[model samples]
Structures are given as structure tokens and as C-alpha cells.
Target: MPDLHSIPYLVGAGIVLLHVIGILHVIHAIMTVRTSQGTIAWMVSLIAAPWIAVPIYWVAGRSRFSGYVRARRSDDAELLKLSDDMHRRLREYEIKPDDAFGRAAQFLGGLPFTRGNELTLLIDGEETFESIFKAIHAAEKYLLVNFFIVKNDRIGTRFKDALIARAKAGVQVYFLFDEIGSHRLSRSYLNEMKEAGIHCSHFGANRHWWSRLQINFRNHRKIVVADGKEGFIGGLNVGDEYLGRDQRFGAWRDTHLKLKGPSVQAIQLVFIEDWNWATDEVPDLEWTGQEHTADQVAAIIPTGPADPADSWQLVVAEAANSAQERLWIASPYFVPDGGVLTALQAAAIRGADVRILIPEKADHLLVWLSAFTYYEQTIPFGVKLYRFKKGFLHQKVILVDNKLACVSTANLDNRSFRLNFEISGLTPDPVFVGEVAEMLENDFGNSEPVKVSDFTARAFWFRLACRVARLMAPVQ
Candidate 1:
């Protein structure tokens, strides 16, 4: 018989307990993990080193968000009524689906492609913010502002002042920000907004006690709606760096969209759902929007972990698969999952010109390094990669032939595909598509084509580091 009090016997028993727990977690990962590669990675790590992997997995493993689904489907009669009313009103402007992408996007977003809409492509920060501030100043009823990051810097102060000005004018302003993204924002800033009769809250996965450990998910959407008539969506957060004022990263190149008509209400609907998630109360706002003369066809697609399927990933893969002539994408992060990467390659192989634009500078070291690993896999299959030489390319844009163009907060990475709440505005209107095309053409003119040798010629240690960084892409 073993000595019950002996240290050696106790240590052995503890190790066995950990392994049993690890095995149970492995089963859980197998059942829950979204991708086969992710499942294999978790299974190996859990079995080989449970002591370290278990905690990390507990924090970041699960792809599906808890509590959010319940909150969205809550039996709150008022919320349900508002949703039904919004849908009914939107149906009046809904356009019939003319393509596979349209049908799939509508099914995934639960919103229709609307007519009588106008989309203005706002290039870079100054133009985008100017338009946003102008709309904020002109607000007659209510304003909804949301962003992934809202630094308390120069531009942030301007943004705050704009909201305050509108709020003091008797406009109901509801501001929402991501908790982790705006962690540096002072309490005073929020208090000041509250003092001016504005409703402000931070959104995160930590709303419930059980979800505190699931901090990996983030609300990465950047949105601004004014009086439910005009809206903005894109990559620029409220910060001085986005304005190209940061010396470290000069000339911030990004894209934003100024939307009008029925599409603006669609954007507002997304904001209402997000605000409800944060505050559990929906503010009353205008549900009807005036139709613009442009009459462009557009849709707003919002995707997150609360979704039943990996919505953004499927949307991107569908974009690639549906590309007839050319597929072009520009993003700050390019660490796509296996499915997206395969789709990109398949598009190139099927005689479609596939091109990816990325920034030359390293904003996130791991993400930048991970991108290098994709060169070999992509270039061999005829896909072209370009590095923006003029400035940091932070635009999340996609062009599928001359048919569809999209500006979004979603990136070509696993984080955006699964871990973050993201939104995109897509339009097939030829005029809007032409504007997007001209903008991308100018951006492409400022970029340099990347060759396979760019990665292969790197030093052995650097290449090895890149490969190592690629392993962390799923969580990044």
C-alpha cells in the first residue's frame, strides 16, 4: 500500500488528476473547436502539456461566444417588437437578390440588400472624420457612435466635443465602445459625456461571470449614425494615429463609407443591437430614412461569435469563389485561415486575377511576420501580393470583379473571421463600384508588387521566426 502522507505519492496523484482533466478538455475541444487544424492543435497541446495548455485553452479556446446569444434571443417583448418593426420597414426598400453572394449575404446577416441608397467612399482619415463630424453637427434627433478604439487624444477630444455639442442641443446621443480597446480612456471622459446627458457604455465578453475568462472576443466594429439618416463605417478609430499624426507610422491610409437612405437605417439597426448588448436598453430613434436620388443598391453585413456559422469567413470565401474577372483585397492583417487561403488560391487557379494588398510597416509584429509565411503558399498558385509603399494600409476593402465592392472593419485574418464582431457595407451599384475601383487603383499605384523571393531571400532565422509566428495566428 502507498503512504497517504508521502509527498511523492501526492505529487503522482495530482499529475494523474491533471491528465484526467486534460482528457476531458480535449473532448470538449474536439466537440467545440471550429477548424480541423485548430482541433488538432488543441488536442496535441492538451495531451502533451495539460498544465500550461489547459489555462490558455480555457481563456481563448472556445470560438462561440456565451451569454450574447441568450441576450440577443431574450424574451424581451419590447426588443422583439422593435426588431420586427425594423424588419417590416426595411422590407419596403429591400431589393431582390440577383446573385449567389447577395442571397448568401442576406441569409447570413438577416438583412436585405436595399435600394434608394447612396454610398460615398471617404478615403483616408481627414476626409472621413470631416464627413462624420459634419453629420454629427447636423443631427436633429439622435446619434449613435461606436468604435473599437477611442483614445483620449487630440482627435478623440474633438470627437468627444462633437458628441457633447449635439447632446447639449437636445439630441439623444448613445455612445458605445469596446471595453478592451478603450481601456486607456479615462473615467473622466465618460463621466463628462454622462454629465451632458449622453448614454455611454463599453461592450465586451465579460458581461457574465462565466464569460470573464473569454476575453479574447472583441467588438471590432467602427460605426457612426446620425439621426438615423447618415452613417459611417470603416477602419479609422478615434485616435491621433489614424489622422497620420503619429511620427512612428506616418500617412495612415484607410477607407470609410458615408451611407444614406435605407442603408443608414440598416447600419443603425446594428448599433441598436450592440447598444442593447451593452446596456440592455434600446434608445428610441428614427426608423424611417429618406431615399436618396442615387438609388444605389447596398447591404450591411454584421458577423460575430454569436452567429450560428462562421459568417465572415463564409462571406469572404464566397467572394473569392464568385469572382469572375478579378479579386482584390486590402487589409492590415493577412493571416487568413486555411479555408480562405484555399479559396484565394482556387480563384487564381480558375483564371481570376487575385491580388492582396498589405502594409510594408509592422504594426503588429506577429501578424506582420505571419504574413510572410503565406507568400510561398500563395505566389506558387499565381496569387499576387503587394506591399503599400506610401503608408500603412489599414483599409479593409474587397473588390470582386466590377460587380461588388466592400469597405469593412473585418480583416483577412482569423481574429476578424471568428473572434471579433465585424461589419461591412457592400454594393453592386456600378457608380459606387467605379468609385471604389478608382480609389483602389490609386492605392495600387502607390504600392510595390511583392515577389516570392521577398520571403525566400530572408535570413534563415527570420524565416523561422515567421513560421513560428504563423502558429499564433488563430489567437491573434
Candidate 2:
């Protein structure tokens, strides 16, 4: 009754439809994808294996975040007014003779390097969480909170309780987290926050039906802004694992920063934009920031795929290019793009002390393996490599000579450079740089230098596997 003789015709039609969809996707990749390597890889896969590749491409191939872009543009008028007001308030404490990095940060992050800001480095989970809790408890007016992952564990529960108490006290509290990154966060956990009168939502790439299938882009920022007078940002998310409770990654290593003064206003703006996208309500926040006499000049740089260009990629290369003496970097992942790699090689050849420190124990196997493929090309150019043997190194830090230091949530991988929403605190203060230098010195003391023989002596099959993983770098 089902017309069994038409089976061959149905199969033929399906094949034709697949190719048609594949061809359309190929065109989309060529026109929309920003990276040439990504475009070519997707095109070939879509053409050769449409059945599997088409779905994957539809979900992950798009580079520009249309929803965020549109939301930002829609709020242009209010944001412009806010920017003007902030600049006016920050003008009295403005620092002159700002370096290229500072200037670029002002333009890109829409935040200027205002003086009179106090910055303190919080090392690892114990110190970072302690600082954050104290700051949250001190919140008098409002608090802006965002993270990539917010667990329901011990630390997370403490964090929730603190916020709930503050909300009950009538201090406006806004909490935002990424849906994909916090997929394990129980619904009851979110409901509890809502019941406690905390404004909570998830930032995600799901504004459109097509985007609902796309989970590649993530909000990887971890920020806390309290009363527009203090702020925090860095690599640590809300989880028990970050506190060294997880047996898998024992003694987790990370870094966070605490800022008090005008820079907090900039961090507050980032949360405002993200919250606007989540709730479409741009609530009024304090504009004027407290000033200090400290000589520290800092800027908050926020980058994402919605940007006209790859911002962090350019920043990475610039850090290498502008290094007068030393360029040190530490990241959990070490998959640099071609431009950044070339910049590092050139800097090393030009007599700069270029060092890249990565964790020996990896959470992502492919990224760990792919890093080996790059050693042979970089090490010969005087670029030093070190592997941190003390647990998993998850901090995103960069030190340039004695002038600049950065603590950020952006990794040295394609994902952070292209796909994720990331923020970094850049400072030209000698005090901050000295602290970072000391930290890196201790890190280097604990790490073991990687030699040329280490990579060269790998087994043939292992080398082959690394090479194959390296081929996936564009998408990784």
C-alpha cells in the first residue's frame, strides 16, 4: 500500500536535496565565514559529505553574532549617551601619553584608562572567592554578576546565598550566566534565585531558530560589578572544581583581579550590554565612579565574534610585536593562529625574551596534542616553552616587558580569539606589572622547560595524531 516501487525514486530525491543544501551551505561559508581556513574546510566537508556536514555547519559555521550586533545597534542612542557621560566623569583622572595598547583598548572596549584606580591580584580560588564574597556583601546599591559557568555546588551555593541575602535587603541584583556553559546548573537553582527576588537570566546564542541549534559561541566572561565602585574579572568560574575539590584536576590554578575606582564603571558597561541582550531592559545604573590617588592606569578590553575584526588575535600579535624586552604568556590552551605564531617567531628572532607557559596536564586532549605540532616551528626561533607541572594552569595572563600586564578570560586558542565573548584588564601601572612579573617568575620556577627533543622524540603514530589534531585548529 505504501508504493514500495517508489523507494529508489525517494532515495534519489533525497540525495539531490542533500547536495542542493550542501551547495547552499558552501556558498554561505564562502560569503560569511571570516577565516579562510574555516571557509575552505567547511566547503569541502559540505560538498563531500553533505549528510553529516550540513547539520554541523548550520549549527557552528556562522561567525558573526547577529543577535548581539542588532541588540547593540538598537541600544545605540542610550549607549552613546552613557559613553559620553562616562567619559566626562573619567576626564578629570585621565592619563596622558598612553601606549598603543591603551589607545586600542579605549577604542575597542569603549573604556578609557582613567587614573586613580586600585587593582589587586587574587591568586587561585580561595583568595578570589574570598574577595568576591566580601565585595558582594558590601554591595549597597546594585550588583552586576556574570559568568560562563555557575555550578550548584558548595561554592555556588554560597555565592547564591550571598546574592539572595543582598537582594532581600533591597539591593538590586542582576545575575547572568551562559546557558551552554552552565548546562548542568539545575533549574531549581535558578528558580531559587528568582524566588529570592534576584534578576537572573542566561546569555545564549538562541535568538533565532537557526541559532537555537548553534551552541558554538559562548559567553566566557566572569565579571562582578558592585555599586559601580568595585569590580572583578578573570578566569575563575563558579564551581567546586575551581576550589580544588575535584579529584580529576587536583590543585586548580587560576588568577583573578579586584579593581576599586573608575575602571569599575567600564566593567559595569560590559554587564549592561550583556544584560540588555538577555532581558532587553537597560536599567539605570550609577555612572560616576569613585576616584583615588593611585597612579595605576587601566582599561577593560571586551572582545567577541560580533566585532568587525578578530580583536584578541590582533591584541596577541600586538603584544608580541610591541615587546621591547620580554613577552610572557600563560594559558590553558596554546593553539595560536598563524599571525600570532608568526609574530612570536619574529619577536623571538629580534632578541625579545618570548616565553609561552602551558599546562602539562590538559583538560582538552586535542588541544594538548595539537600544541606539540607547533613546538618544532617556534622553539628554533628562540621562543622558550615551559610546561606547568603543578596541577592544571587555567589562567590567561600576559606580561610585556616592564610596561604592561593583562589578566583575562581569553585563552590562546581559536575559540577565545574568535568565538567567545571575553574581557581582559590591561594596566600600565608598574605596581601591577611588578606583581605579575613576580607571579610569572614563581610560575616559571615551578614549570619545566620543553626541549626540542621532547617533541621530536614522540612516536610516529603519536606525531601523526598531533598533526591531525592540528588540522582542526581553525575550528577548535
Candidate 3:
């Protein structure tokens, strides 16, 4: 009954439309894709197969986070003035030499390493939650809380209740969460927070339509800044698994840090910028100059796709490049980009002790499989890999040569390196570095050393699957 003769003409028209869309998308990819490999891959695919590639490009090709960038620039002049003022005030609190990380922070458009800060390493979830709750209860002036994932489970309810209590006590509470990461979060939960007087919003809630569809970019940072005096940042999120309640993960292991001093100011600034982008309203808080005693030196580096370059990625690479005695890293994921892998291999080849610690249990199948591909290439270069047996290892802590240490939410994978927003605290204090060293020592002790034979002895299909997973590394 259909027009059989018109089928050829209809097919020609569809082919023309697909080609037009594909060509336009190729130009867009060339203009927007951050990495050269990504651009070439998209261009070739778009030209080879128009229909399939065009849809895929629309969903995943974009790398820059234009929405947040626009929101950040809305009040550019005012923010610049404020930043200059803060820098002028921080000049007196700057630390002495042996602070290469301070220069790296400057490159990232962040504050320098300041003295007079006290740092406490919270080993796992129980200590982290306890310290955070106690700090929230002590909030008098203002409170800021942000996390990538905020579940409505046991720990999430506790976090919500703490904020509600503070809000009812006349404390100005500002809460931010990632809509994508917390997609399971209920509307009723958000309504309850609004009813309790907490100013809360999703990070990219009001983004442009096109940008909203590009959901790859995420605010993966977890932070809590209270009273402009203390702050917390690290890997643990507000969920029951983080507290080791989920039997699937068995006993969960992670790390967090609590800081009191000028370092808190640097962390608070990171929160303020994210808060401003989300709500487009600035809160009144203290920028008062406090006296310094030069107790400990630390800097906060916040990185995202909005930046001119990959600051957090460069941080990891530079640390690997600069290590002399040893380089130790523990992350839940280990899918490093070319630059980072090269840096680690070079570090090991140059006689530095290079060790990478990953979890025995995997939370993401693609990432877990892809990580094996790297083992074959790196193990021969004096790079040692270990797998934690106690439980999952989700900490993003790094120890560099017993002098520099980092703790943050940034993973070693491409997602944190380029896509997700991250905040890392860099410290050059030996005392703090020593603490990190001891913690990692215990972690490495419990972990089983991986041998090259492990992967070489795998089945044929298993090897093929690992290779296939590795092929998806750039996108994953």
C-alpha cells in the first residue's frame, strides 16, 4: 500500500540529512573537544558513519563545561576584585621554601601554601562522620556543605538532620549536591531541606538545554566548611556504604581530613565559587586576617574542565615526575591518561619507589577491567601494584618522597583528570606527610602484591574482554 517507488528518494533524503548533521558535528567536535585523540576519533567516526556517530557525538563528545563557566563569569569583575583582595591578605601568611606545590597551585589559579594551619587525618568513615557532625553542631555564623552523592540512607539522614538542626538554630546553612550523582534522591527529601530553611540546590540545575543533556561533567568534590574556621574534604560521601553498612562492599575503607587555620580559608573559597555558580548569590562570610604561627603549610587546588588546562591532572603528573625517594598512591580507580602513565613509568625507571594501590573489589566493571591492561605495561618498569584485601580502597591520598602529601576527591582515572570537578589539599609539612606515610604503610602491608603472571595466565576470552575494556578507556 506504501509508495514503493518513492522509497529510493526517501532514502536519499535521509542520507543527505544524516551527512549534513554529521559534518556539522565534526566541526563542533574539532572546536570543542579538549584532547587531540578525542577530536580525531570523533571526526573519523562522523565521516565514516553519519547516522550512528552523530547521535553518539551529541551525547558524549563535549568536554568543556560551558554552563559552569558562564555562571562563573557572570560576576567576573567582582570576583576578580575579591580574589585580588584575598591574595593581598594572604601574602603575610605565605610559607617558606621547599613548597614547589605552592607554585603549582598558582598555575591552577589557586591560593598559595599558607602557614598556621592544623591538619587532622580522619582514617575512615566513622571518624570522618563523627568529626563532621561535631563540627556542624558547633556552627555559629555560617555553614557550607557539598557532596557528589547524598543518599537518603542512614548516614544521609544523619547528615540531613544535622543541617536541619543548625538551620533551626539561626545558623545560615548552604547545601549543594550533584543532581546526576544523587539522581536517586527524592523530591520529598529536597522539600524537607527547603522546609527546614536550608538553602540547597543542584550544581547544574539551571543549565542551558543543550548543556543539560551533556551530563558527563560532574561536581565530584565533597566538602564541608563551617564558621570560616574549619573545613573537611576527602573521598567519603554521605551514604551508608561509606559507613561500611552495605554488605556488598563488606568493610569499606576511605580517608578524610579536618583542618583548622588559614588552609580553611582556601577551602572555603573553593566552596564559595561552587555555591555562587549554583545559586548565583554570594553569602556574607568572614575574610578577616588572622595571626599566623607558621605551624603547618598547605594549599588547596580546585580543578575542573572550566580551567584553561587540566590542573588536577598536572598535579598528579608533576608529583610523579618530582618524586625522588618514593611515590605512593591509593585510588579506587586507576585508568590514567597517557601523560600520567608515562610520568609514573618514568618515575619508576629513574629508581624511585613507585607503588600503586587499588581495591580487590570493584565498583565499576569497565574501570576494573581496563586497569588490568595497564599492569602488563607498567610492571616491568619497576612499578609495583598492590590490591587491598581488607575491603574496598577509595581514598585518593598520595605520598611523594616523604615531604609532600595530597588528600582529595580526585581519582587517578580520566574522569577526575578531565571531566569531574576536584579539590586537593597539598601539604609540605613533614609531620603531616609522616602521618600519611604511616597510613599508606599500613594499607600497603595489608594489600597483596600483584605479579605479572596474574594477567598473563588469564583465559583467552578474559584477555579479549580486558583489551575491549581498555579500548573504552578514553570514553570511560
lDDT of 3 by residue, 299-366 (tens): 88899988878877888888899888899999999998889999999999999999999999989899
- TM-score of candidate 3 to 2 decimals: 0.96
Q: What is the TM-score of each candidate against the true structure?
A: 0.97, 0.97, 0.96
User: Under the 3 Å rule for N, CA and C atoms, how many clashes does model 1 have?
Assistant: 0
TM-score of 1: 0.97
Candidates, ranked, TM-score: 1, 2, 3
Ranking by lDDT: 1, 2, 3
Per-candidate clashes, comma-separated: 0, 0, 0
Per-residue lDDT, model 1, residue 234, is 96
Off by over 4 Å in 2: none
Query: Is candidate 1 or 3 superior in TM-score?
Result: 1
lDDT: the better of candidates 2 and 3 = 2
| Model 3 residue-pair collision total | 0
lDDT of 2 by residue, 370-423 (tens): 999889989999999999988889999999999999999999999988899999
C-alpha local distance difference test of each model: 0.91, 0.89, 0.86
